[model samples]
Target chain A: MSLYYVQKFIYNINRDTKLQTGFAANADMILANYDLTDEEACALREADIGLLYVMGVNGQLLMHYAAYRGLAWDDYIQAMKDGLAKYGEVRAGSYVTIDGGAGGAV
Target chain B: MSLVFAGLCSHAPGITARAERAPAELREPFFANFNIMRQQLEAAKPDALIVIAAEHFANFFMDNMPAYAMGAAPYYEGPIEDPDWLKIKRRKIPGNANLSFRLIKTIMQDIDLAYSEEWKCDHGIMVPLHFLTPNYDIDIIPVNINCQTAPFTPLKRAWAFGKALRKACDFVDERIAIVATGGISHWPATPNSGKINEAWDRDFLDKFARNDKTALLAYNDEAVYADAGQGGAEIRTFIALAGAVEGRKINIAFYAPIPIYAVGCTIAMVDLDES
Candidate 1:
C-alpha cells in the first residue's frame, strides 16, 4: 500500500526488539499499529519480497528486511530477480524497472 | 601542497569477511582489484585521510540530516552496527582533530560550506577504511554527505565542496589523502536491490579513469537518479573527490561487480602529483 509504512515496519523491527518479537509472534498484532493496505500487510507477514517489490517498496528499506529474514546475499538478489519475473514491473517505488518492461536493466 | 593522493571506492560491509562465499569467477577479480588499491594507498602513505561517504542515517536520521558534516573528534569510534556480521573489528579509528578543525574552520568561515562537527561515522566510512587502511595507523578526517536522504546536495555542489576541501587542505600542515566512498549502480534495499548495472558502472569508471570530469558532470541529478537508485547518489562522493583533484590523472585500479553484495564496486587512484 505505502512504501513509507513498509520501510517504517522494517526499520523499526530491525532496531526494536519488542517490535521484532511482536512481528515474529503475531504479525497481525504489530501490523495493526500501521495503516497499511491488505497487500502490504500480507507481503510483510509472508516476508514476500517479490510481492513487496510489485507494491513498490524501496530497495534500501527492502534490503534490511531481507537481511532480517536471514537471507544470504545471493539469495536476496535472486529473490529480487524472481520478484520481477513473477510480479512484472516494480508496481511502485524508486526502482520501478527502467528499460521498459524488463525486470532488470539488462 | 598538502594533498598527496585522492580516490574513490565502494563500501560493501560483508564483502571483506565473506567474499569466499561468492562464486570464484566474480570473487577473484574483485579481491585482486581490492588488493591493488590497498597497495596503492600504502605507497602514497599520506599522513591523513579525509573520507567522504553517504550517511545511511547512522549518525543522523531523517529528522536532522545535514547535507555535509565533518567529524573532528580526537578519537573517532566506529563500525557502529553489526561489527561481527561485517567481519570488521570494532575499534576506535584514530582521528586528526587538529586538521579536521582547520578544514572545518576554513570551509565554514571562508567557503561558507554547511557543516556539522558532531557527526559520528557508520559502515560507510569504516568499510572502506577497513580494507584500504587495515593498520589504522594514519589519522582520519570523516566527512559525510546526505546521499540517502531527500533534498540531498546536488552533484555540481558536491564537486564544488571538494574544491573547497582542497583549499582547506592547502591551509593545513598535514599531507592529506582524500577518499570518496560509494556507488556504481545497485539498489540497496528494494526488491530489485541486487540488480547490478555493469554497463553503467563500466561507463562511469571509463570516464573517471580518463579524467573526463566533463562527462562525469554530464550526468545530472535526474539522469543518475533515474538510472541508479537513491543510494546510488553516493557517486556524488566521488564527484567531490574529482573537484578536489581537478586535473589529476585517474587510475582505475579496480572494477568488479559483486552481485552477492549487490554492489558494482570500483577502486580508483587520483594522482595529485601529476600536475
Candidate 2:
C-alpha cells in the first residue's frame, strides 16, 4: 500500500531475532503476515533494494534493510539511484523524486 | 562550573571511514575540520566527556521509548552491529558512572528525564568518540536524546534540558567536555535522501556560529523536519548543547555535504575560558 507492510517487515526483522531467523529460514512465509503487495513481497524476498525504493520505503527503514542484506553502504546508496533510473519515478512516499532529480516531495 | 571544553560533531559513519568511498576532493575538507576539532580537544585536556547524541532504535524501541536518558553503565560495550560496514572498529568505551550518577541526581532537580544503568553505545555516541577521542581513555557520560523516535523532545524543551544539564555538570567537580552530534540537512535511505539543503545548512550553521540561540530555538517543529528530515531532528542534540554554552563565541571548524552517508558533516565548538 504505502510501503507500510514493507517498512514494517524490515523494521520487525531488524529488531526481532526470532523473526530474522524465521525470515532466513522461510522468507515468503515470514513476509506473508504483513499486508504487502506481491511486488513488495518479491522485493523483500530478492533483497531488491531498487524496487523497494520505488515502492516508497522510507530511507531510515531501507538503510537497515540494505544492511540486513549485507549490502555495503555505498552499494545500498547506488541501488536507490539505480532504482530511480530503472523505475522511472518514485511511485509514492514523503520523498518522491521530482523532475527525475534529487529533490523530493517533502 | 568546570566546563573546560565543548563542541558539536557529526556522527555520520562516512566521516570515520571516508577513505573507503569518499573521493579525495570530498574527504579533504571533512578531515581538515576534524583535525581542527581534534586540536581543540587536545588543548582542552578534559578528564571526562559528556556526549549528547541520538539513538537509532538501537537500544530503546516504540514500546519503551524515553524522551531522554543517561547510560550509567561503567562501560558502554559499543554497538552490537556496525551499520558502517566495519568502516569503524568497535571498542568498549569507558563510562563515568560516578559523574553520570551525579548528573542524574542534579539534573533531576530541574527536569524529570530518564537514565539507564545498562545500555550499549551506538554510532551516534561512538562515531564522534572514534574520531575525536580515538584512545577511548577519557571517562564518557553518554546522554541519549531520542531524536529518531517520534513524539520527540521539543526544541524549546531540548534547550531547557541543556540548561538543566549545565546545572548538573556544575554540580560535578571535574573538567568536562560536552559534545553534540548530528545534523545540517540530508536524509538517509530514500531516493532523494542524499540531496543537501545547502541553504538550510549554511543558515543554521551561521546562526550557531554567531551564538544566536534565540533564532535557533525559535524554529518551528514543522520547519525543522521539512528542512532537515526526520533524523536531522537530531539537531535538537545541538540545541541542548547550545543551551549549555549560550552567549559564548562559536567556531564552525568544518562542514561537508557527504552524499555517501546522506548527511552534512558539520563540526563546531564554543571555547570556554575557565580563568
Candidate 3:
C-alpha cells in the first residue's frame, strides 16, 4: 500500500487527549483490519490526528496560521489523504496517515 | 541562451511600488538590487520580459485547473487593489501578443498543455512586474503555473518547461529577461508561524547559485516541504527559471530573511553567455 507522511506538532496529541485517544483507537482498528506496515500504521495515526485537528473547532484558526493559505476544506482533506497514502503509516509519533481516497481511513 | 537573473520573493504585504513603505532597512537594499537588475535588463534590452510565476487561484480554481496558463494579450492588467501596485501615474505597458501567442502555440504543439488569451496578472506576476517595470510600460509575456493545487509540476518537469521557454523566446527573436519569483522558506501564519529555515534557505541559495539543475529537479514536494516550511510551493518558480536558462551562471544580489512574514526575500541575476 502507498503511504504518505503527515508532520505536525507533538503537542497536538497531548493537548487534546480525547481526540487523540479516538484517533489512535481508530488507527489501531484500521491496522488490525487491513494489511499495513509499521510505517503505514504511523502514517495513518498522523493523518487521523491531523484530520482531527483540521476538523476541530479551532481548525480554521490553525489553518489560517498554518502554511495552507486560501486552501479549501475539501482540498486540505484530499492533501492529507494523499500524504497518508504516499508515505504509508507514520512510524514517528510526530506524523500521521490516510488512505489517499474517499471513505476516510477504512 | 544565457540567464539574465534568477531570484526569490515573498508575496505578502502585496506588491507595493512605494519604496518608502518597504521595511526601512530593506528599502535601500531593495532599490539598489533593482538598480543592478535594471541595468542588466537594459543591457539585454529584451523586447519583452517573460515572467514565470505561480497563480494564487487567480484564473484557475477547484473546478477547473490548468497545469499552465500563458497570457496572449496586447496588455494585461494586474490584480486590482486599493493601493494598486501599478499606480495610475505609471504608464501602462503593452504586451507582445503576437510573440506571446506564437510562443504558446509552439509550446502547445510540442507538449500537451492549455493556453489562455484572457487573464489578469495576479500578485505572483505583479510582484516581479512591479520591480522589473515599476511604470508598467514594458511588453510582458506572462506564464502562470498552478503551484497551489496537487499533481503539481514536478521539479524536473518545471525545469524542462523552462528550457522550452528559452526556445519560445528565441523564436520571437527578442532579447528577453526572465524573472522567477516566490520563496526562500517562510510560513505566513501562526500556531507554527513566523518560521524561517535558515539552513535550508542557505542550502537552496547555494545550489541555485551553482545552477544545480539535477539536484533541484530531484526534489519532491515532501522534500521541499521539509526544507522550505509548509508553503514551499514557490520553490517551483526556481525550477522553472533553471529550465529557462538551462546552463547559465547565477549572480545573487540580496538575501534577507523576513521573520514577520516568515519568508526570506532575495534577488538574483542570471547571465547567459551568448558567445
Q: Top model by lDDT, which number?
A: 2
Task: Give the share of true interchain contacts found in each model.
Answer: 0.24, 0.29, 0.00
Worst 10 residues of 1 chain B by lDDT: B110-119
- Which of candidates 1 and 2 is the stronger one according to lDDT? 2
Tens-digit lDDT track of model 3 for B1-275: 33343444445432243334447786667657866776677677666787777765545544577777787878776453222322423234468778777788767755555667666654567666666676676788777777765777777777777777777666665566777777767543212334667778888878888889877776778777665654576787877777776677677788776544345667887756544
Which 10 residues in a row give candidate 2 chain B its minimum summed lDDT?
A: B79-88
Regions of candidate 3 where Cα sits further than 4 Å from its true position: A1-106, B1-10, B14-23, B81-93, B189-193
> Per-residue CA lDDT of candidate 1, range A1-106, in tens?
4667776776667545467777888889999887788978888888898777667765555665666676765676677778878888777556565543333311
The C-alpha TM-scores of every prediction are 0.78, 0.83, 0.67
User: What DockQ, between 0 and 1, does each candidate earn?
Assistant: 0.23, 0.29, 0.03
TM-score of 2: 0.83
- Interface RMSD, candidates in the order listed: 4.7, 4.9, 15.9
lDDT of 2 by residue, B1-275 (tens): 57888899888655554454666787787777777787788788887888888866556755577888888888886653444563666567888787788888988887787988877665677778877888888888888887775677888889889888888887778887899887768665565656778889999888878878788888876787777765567888888888888777678887777776568778888868722
What is candidate 1's CA lDDT for residue B62?
53
Write the residue-wise lDDT of candidate 1 on B65-172 in tens digits. Answer: 678888887777766544555567668788877778888888776344445445455568887887788889988888888787567777778878888999888888
* Candidate that scores best on TM-score: 2
Q: Which of candidates 1 and 3 is the stronger one according to DockQ? A: 1
Question: Scoring model 1 with DockQ, what do you get?
Answer: 0.23
Stretches of candidate 1 above 4 Å error?
A1-58, A65-71, A74-92, A95-106, B109-120, B229-231
Decreasing lDDT order of the candidates: 2, 1, 3
